[model samples]
Every structure is written in structure tokens, then in C-alpha cells.
Target chain A: MKILVCISNVPDTTTKITFSLDGKAFNTAGVQFVINPYDEYALTRAIELKEAQGGSVTVLNVGEADTEPNIRKALAIGADDAIRVNLKPTDAFLVSQQIAHYAQEGGYDLILMGRESIDYNGFQVHGMVGELLGIPTIAPAIKLDVNGSTATLEREIEGGKEIIEASLPLVVSAQQPMAEPRIPNMRGIMTARTKPLKVVEPVGQDAKTSVQNYELPPAKSGVKMIDAENAGDLIKLLRNEAKVL
Target chain B: MSVLVVIECANGEVKKSSLEAASYGSKVAAALGTSATAVAIGDVQANALASLGEQGITKVLLDNDSRLHDFVAAAYVKVISKAAESENSSVIVLSNSNIGAAIGSRLAVKLGASLATNVVALPQINGSSFTVRRGVFSGKALSDVELSSDKKIIAVKKNAVDIETTAGGTATVENFSADLADADFATAPKETIRQSGDILLTEADLVVSGGRGLKGPENWHLIEDLAKTLGAATACSKPVADVGWRPHHEHVGQTGITVSPNLYIAVGISGAIQHLAGVNSSKVIVVINKDPEAPFFKAADYGIVGDATEIVPKLIEAAKALDK
Candidate 1:
């Protein structure tokens, strides 16, 4: 089994988000970048599958040179090798196009990634890639298990879960509870330094959408702190003041 | 050029978010000086489809395919694609749902359209320049994106748009078929397990959420008591789910469900920035924590500094009294 797991570089979940002066892009100065939390579920799950089934797992990323450290981190976690398409992903369409171009050539039996990246939060790539490759795609899956030639998944729907079965050569997007993400230990970190990290040029495609500008969400007014014993007052406030009842 | 709205139905009725999408789509059609046509999927009554006129939709196309009763992404893409083509639709609107995102991305590729999810507002179409405001960075910020394609697909966020009521007449319902093939249903679900609850988190106007402050799963009755009294949905912070105190579906945070209910009450959870990112869009926020310095109080509109065990039961009693 050859599995290709896709990862994305995003700011640490606790970081205060700020855009550049022009508001066209996210600022990188003094900011720590980590593998998108959701993608970690995918990467770790792929590694677990490879360990059990005796196969190789390759991690892929579509980003510029700045995203390498996190790509290396994936290798340290357990991927056999890595591939980075050197391009700043502007939109989901271009990013999906890049992944489809590579996955078609790699001929991996299973391709997995997070349900959505934290930055843009497009939630579009898995389906786009599946469409581009003419394959089946199951998304936001909370559980996945592979049998001889088929894979069973528990996918999240609105207010429910669906049990799905698909053949090999399919795409699945990871969400919470798929698998616990593993941290890189000292031994894994030492060996990852020598693992193959291939950087390739991006394929050509025009991004269909472009960011014009970004605006921060408005700040909240100060809170009205009611006393602990007066918890019942909060109900009246929600009903009469907020009018939300 | 007509605008097409994809209406998702369950239990033979249209979803509230789908009604908001219909409202948004009808307004977009009016902005473009065209009519808005809806294509209903799933088990929907013809009368329910006709009621879409309340949201300004003028026509409804009902597809009674049994294969579409359960969501199949490819089949849905085909159905919407054929509807768009037949109606000459340039803009397609849907709810930012699991089903919507699954098909929106594929349809963008299949129809050469620009796809935008989590859209918060209608497009500002100024001569060929179509710009839309969408929530980004997990609702911490908003971005204006320009869709340069001739075709555009938008997934409207829940509760972002008010349902329009000016279009009062019943929509003309028409029978439609996409002539779907067996291959389109290749990935149909084997079984579906629906969550049982009085109110779904995404559709709820008020939510009562718990955190580690409750101490253990044994104390969850406080959260449920308050939720039941107020008739609100129940949610939990990520740690509670991680520790197995609650199910993953009840988790709400940066990597979990993002909801924008009218009122959000966080109990015993410190306001982590990650948790706030999922819920800052809420109209009114209330935090109940024993600690005075919990970060969530800063974002909340109202707060009570108290122990969950002591304060929650009182709140439930108060809510019960108010209901009378």
C-alpha cells in the first residue's frame, strides 16, 4: 500500500492573527508556524496504516520554501519521504490542481488530508482533487479502517454520521477522533534529517479567486458581570435585553 | 441568466440554513435582474418546495431520485450541474454544509466556476468585478475575495442572512431529472446514524456549552439541565471530548464545529483563543466560570463568576420560572 498524506503549514492555533500592511496576506514576522492541526490527524493515521500494512507513506505539501520545516516535521513523525511543490497556494482551485497533478503520477492507492486547512478554511480541496482524478472522495471522516482491497470510513454529516465503503485509490479527509496525532521523539527526529525531501516546481494554473483585502472582526463591548448568586438575573437579561429568547 | 439555489431537505422539510441560502440567492438574482430557481434534493414534500417562495424563490425543481435521498457527492454534483446548465445559471448558492462543500468544490471544477465557502454577505458585483466577504481564519477575520470566473458558486454560512418574506406567492414546482447513472452513486453511504437531540448545534439559536470546570462526565447533567430548561443545544470544549467525557460531535473549537447561535453560554471553560475562534460571531455570549480572569469573559456580553455546580442549577431554575 502506498499512501500519500497532504499537510498544510499554518500559524499556531494560539497565535494572534494579523495581516500585512496591505491586508493582502498573513504576516509571518515573529510568528511560529506549525502543521495544521487537522492535517496532523491525517499524517498520523497514514503512518499508522503504513506500520500495520507494511507500506510506505509519502507526505505532500503545496507551498513555498517557508513551509519546509513543517514538511520535515511530518517526515519526523513517520513519513518515509516528502514532496513540496514550490508555490504559494493562492486559492483552493490551484492547490487542488497541484495535488491532483502529483497524485495522478504517484499512483498512490490512498490519498488523505485534513478536512480543511485553518487559514483559508476552504473545505474544497479533497472533492476538487477527487473530481480532477475521477475518483471517489469521502470527507471529514472521523474513523477509517482499511481491509484487503476496500476501505471503510465513518464520515460526519450534519447532525449525524454515515458509514461508507469504497475501493482502493480513493481520497479521504480527516477530522477529529480519526487517530491521536503522534509527536516526534528524539530518535525519529534524528533520522528525519536524512530523509529524502524533494522540492518540485508548480504546475501552471490560474487561480479563480483572489483575496482583495482582509478585515479583523469587530471588538466586543465590555461584559456585564452579574454576581454569582444572581445567576437568575442572566436569564432576564438574555430574554429582555438581548431579545434572543 | 438565472440564479440557482440548492435546497437541502430532511424529514420532508427544507432546512433553516437552506432557507437562508434561498433568501441570499433570490436577492442575488434580483440584483442581477433575473429570476431565482431552486432545485430541491432529498426527501422533500412538493408543498415544502412550493413554500420556498417565502424566501423569494420563484420556481422550484424537485428531483425525486431515490439515490439522492442520501447524499452522494458525485450524484449531487451531477444534479446541480444539470440544473445550472438547463436554467442558464451563472451563480449557484447553497448552505455551507458538509453536503454543500462536498459538491461545491467538485462542481467548481466540472463547470469552471469559482467556489467560495463560508460566505457572510452577498456579492458586490460592480461590472465584471464580483467581490464577496467571507469569514476566514476560523471566524477571527473577514476577507474580500474576487471570483473571476464566469460562473460562481457560494456556500452561505448559517444564520448569516435573514430569510426574505417579500416574495409571498407559492413557487411553481416542476418535476426534474438529471438522468443520473449508476456510477454516480458509487460512493453512497452504507448506513447513516443520525444524532438524537432536541436541537442541532448549527440550527440552534441558543446553546449551553460546558468545559472542564464541571470536573467529570458525571456532572454533565448540569449542562443538560440548563439546556433543557432554556430549550437550547448542548456543546462541549475540545478537552472534554478528548478526555472522553463527551462525544466528538459535541466538540466546538477551532478544529471542531463553528457555530453562530444568537446566545452562547460557556460554563467552566477558560476562553482559549482557539475556542473563541469557533464562536466569536455569536450575537450574545455569556461566560460562567469560577475564575475571575478567564479569557472568555472579555469576548462575552455577559458573565457570571461562580462555580458551575452552584450557578448552573440556579440558572436552570430561573429559566424554568421565566418560561412560566
Candidate 2:
């Protein structure tokens, strides 16, 4: 069995956000980048599946060369090898197409990715890739179990959860409670230095969407503090001022 | 040359987000100088369907597929695609819901349309170049994206647009079919389990959430009492869910369910950036924590420094009194 896992590089959760060049693009200056937390769930689940079922896990990313370090981190966490599509991802459409092209050429049976990247938060790539490859896609799955050729998945719905079943050669967008993300130990980190990291040119489709500009959400007003001594006063404020009740 | 809105229904009525989607599509239709056609799947009341005219829908094509009562992603894609083709729709609109995202992305590929998700505003259509503002970077920023395609699809963010009611008429209801096949049902869910009686967190108007500061799961009664008193939903921070203090469904953070309730009262959880990403969009935020320096107080509209165990019970008592 062979598995493909997709990972994304994003600003760490604690990183303060700022834009550069007149608010045109993200200012990465003095910022630490890490694997998107959701993608870590996907990578961990893929590694677990490979370990249990005896297969190889290949980590894939669509980004510029600067993202290679994060790719190497994924390899250290247990991905057998790595592949980087050499380009800055323009949009979800083109990213899905590039992934689809590679997955088709590689003929991997199970493809997994985080439900949505923390940066773009598009949540479009897995479904698009599934459609591009003409396969079944299960998204935002919280639980997955494999038995021979069939995979059963548990996904969230409106106020509920649904159990679904699909055959092999399937794509899944995974969420948490699936597996615990593993960190790179000293041995794993040392060996990952020599792991095969391949760089290939992007193929198929141009970005259909382009970022015209960007803006930050309005800064929060200073907190309207209420004393804890008179806790009942909050109800009055919520009703009369906030008028939310 | 019409705008197509795909609405999801359960039990017998339209979802709030779908109503917003209908209003959004109808306005798009008016802007395009064409009618808006609605295609709804699953079980819905005719009266409820006809009421869509309030959102400017000209006609509603109802596909009462029993199989659709349980979401089948492939079947839904086929049905919506057929409706779009029949209406000659240049634009398709849906709620940026789990169901919508699942099918809309595939439909974008199948129909060869440019797709946008987390859309906050209507498109600024200039001749052929359509640009839309969408929330990105985990709702930290808004990015204006130009969709350079003749066919375009949009998944509107929940609670993004105000529902328009001035259309002030009833829509024509038409029973429609897409001749769904067995293969389309292949991806059908085997079983579904729902939260019994509480309001759904995402759709709730007021949410009462707690965190590890409550001390233990047994103390969750304070959250429940407050939620019950205010008719609000309950949610928790990631750590509260991670340590099995609360069910995962109640988790509200970047990695969990992102909600935008009208009022979010957070107790005990130190505001982490990931947690803020999910609940920051709430209209009114109230924070209660013992530590004055807790990060959540920064984003809160109203804050109190106190222990949740001591503060929550009194708040519940005060809320019940106000109700009487």
C-alpha cells in the first residue's frame, strides 16, 4: 500500500500578523512558520496508517523553495520521502490541479490532506482533487478505519456526525481526534537530513483566482471592564447595552 | 442567464444560512438583470419553499429525494449541476457550509467554474472580471480575489450577508428532478447521530462557553444552567475538549468548529490565538477569568476578573431572575 499526504506551511498560531508593501502581501519578517496544525493531524494520521498497514508515506507541498524546511520537518515526523511542486501556490484551483497531476502519475491508493489550510482556509483542494482524479472524497473526517479495500470514515454534519464508507483510491480531508501528531526526535531529525526530497515543476492549469488586495480586520476597541464584585451588573449591560439577550 | 442558489433543508424548513444564500443569489440575479432560481434537495414544506420570494427568488425547484434527506455528496452535485445547466446560470451560490463545501468544490471542477469560499461580500462584477472579498488567514484578514472565469461559484460565509426581505412576494414552486442514479448514492452516509435537544452551536444566537478553569467536568452544570437559562448553546476551548473534559463537538477553536454567535460568554479559558480565531467573529464577547492578564480579555467587549466556579453560578442566578 502507498499513501500520499499533503502539508501546508503557515505562520505559527502565536505569530502576530502584519502586511507589507502597502498591505499587498504577508510580511514574514521575524515570523516563525510551522506546519498548519490541521495538516499536522493529517500527516500524523497518514503515518499511523502506513505504520499499521505496512506502506510508504510521501509528503507533498505546493509552495516556493523557502517552504522546504517545513517539508523536511514533515519527513522527520515519519514521512518516508517528500515531493515539492516548485512554485508559490496561486490559488486553490491550481494547487488542486498540481496535486491531482502528481497523484495520478504516482498512482497512490490513499490520499489525505488537512481539511483546510490555516493560511488560505480555502477548504476546496481535496474535493477539487477528488473530482479532478474522478475518485471519492471524504472531507473533514474525524475518524477513519481501514479494512482491506474499504475505508470507513466519520465526518461531522450540521448538528451531527455521519458514518461513510468508500473504496480504495480515495481522498480524505482529515481533522483532529484522528491521531496524535508526533514530533521529530533526535534520531528521526538526523535521518531526515538524507531523506529523498524531490523538486518537480508544476503541471496543468493556471490559477483561476488572484488576490487583488488584502486588509486586516478592524482592531478591537478596549475592553469595557465590569467589576467581578457586582457580577449581576453584567446582565443589565448585556440586555440594555449589548442588547444581545 | 440566471443565478442559481442551492439550499439545504432538514425536517421541513430551510437553514438560516440557506436563506442568506437565497437572499444573496436573488440580489446577484437582480444585479445581473436576470431571475434567481432556487434548487433545494431533501424534505421541505411547500409553504416554506414559497416564502423564498421574500429573498427575491423568482422560482424554486424542489427535488424531494428521500435519499437526499441524508446528504449524498455525489447526488447533491449532480442535482445542483443539472439545475444550474437548466437555468443557464452563470453564477452559483451556496452557504459555506460543510455540505456546500463538499459539493461546491467538486461542482466547480465538474462544471469548470472558478470557485471561492469564505466569501464575505457580493462580487464586484466588471464586465468579465469578477472580484469578491473573502476572509482568509483564519479570519484574521480579508483578501480581495478576482475570479477570472466566465463560470463562477461562491460559497458565502455563514452570517456574512443580511437577509433581504423587501422582495415581498411568493416564489413559484416547481417540482424538479435530476434522474439520480444508484452510483450517486454510493457515497451515502450509513448512519447519522445528532446532538439531542440543545441549539446548534454554529446557529445559536447566544453561546455560553466554559474552559478548564471550571476545574472538572462535573462542574459543567454551571455552563448548562446558564445555557438553559439564556436559551444559548454551550462550547469549550480546545484544552477543555482535549483532556476529555467535554465532548469534541463542543470544542470551539480554529481546529474545531468556528462559530459566530451573537453573544459569546467565555469563562475560564485563557484566550489563545487559535481559540480567538474561531470565536473572534462573535458580535458581543464577555470574558470571566480570575487572572486579569488572561489574553481573552483583550478581545472581549466585556470582561470580569473572577473564578468561573464562583462567577458562573451567580451569573446563572442573575440570568434566571432577569427572565422572570
Best by TM-score: 1
- Chain A TM-scores, per candidate, are 0.98, 0.97
Considering only the true interface residues, what is the Cα RMSD of candidate 2 after superposition? 1.1
User: In order, what lDDT does every prediction score?
Assistant: 0.93, 0.90
Estimate, for each residue in B35-86, the C-alpha lDDT of model 1 and write its tens digit: 9999999998799888888888999998999889999998998999999999
Q: Candidate 2's residue-wise lDDT over B140-159, tens digit each?
A: 77899998878889999987
Instruction: Record all residue pairs in model 2 with backbone atoms less than 3 Å apart, i.e. clashing.
Output: none
Off-target runs (Cα >4 Å) in candidate 1 are none
lDDT of 2 by residue, A1-245 (tens): 78899988899987777887687889999999999888898899888888899989999999999999999999999999999999798799999989999999999999999999888989999999999999989987999888888999999888989999999989999887887889899998998999999999999757888998888888789898888888988988999898998
Chain A vs. native, model 1, TM-score:
0.98
The number of clashing residue pairs in each candidate reads 0, 0
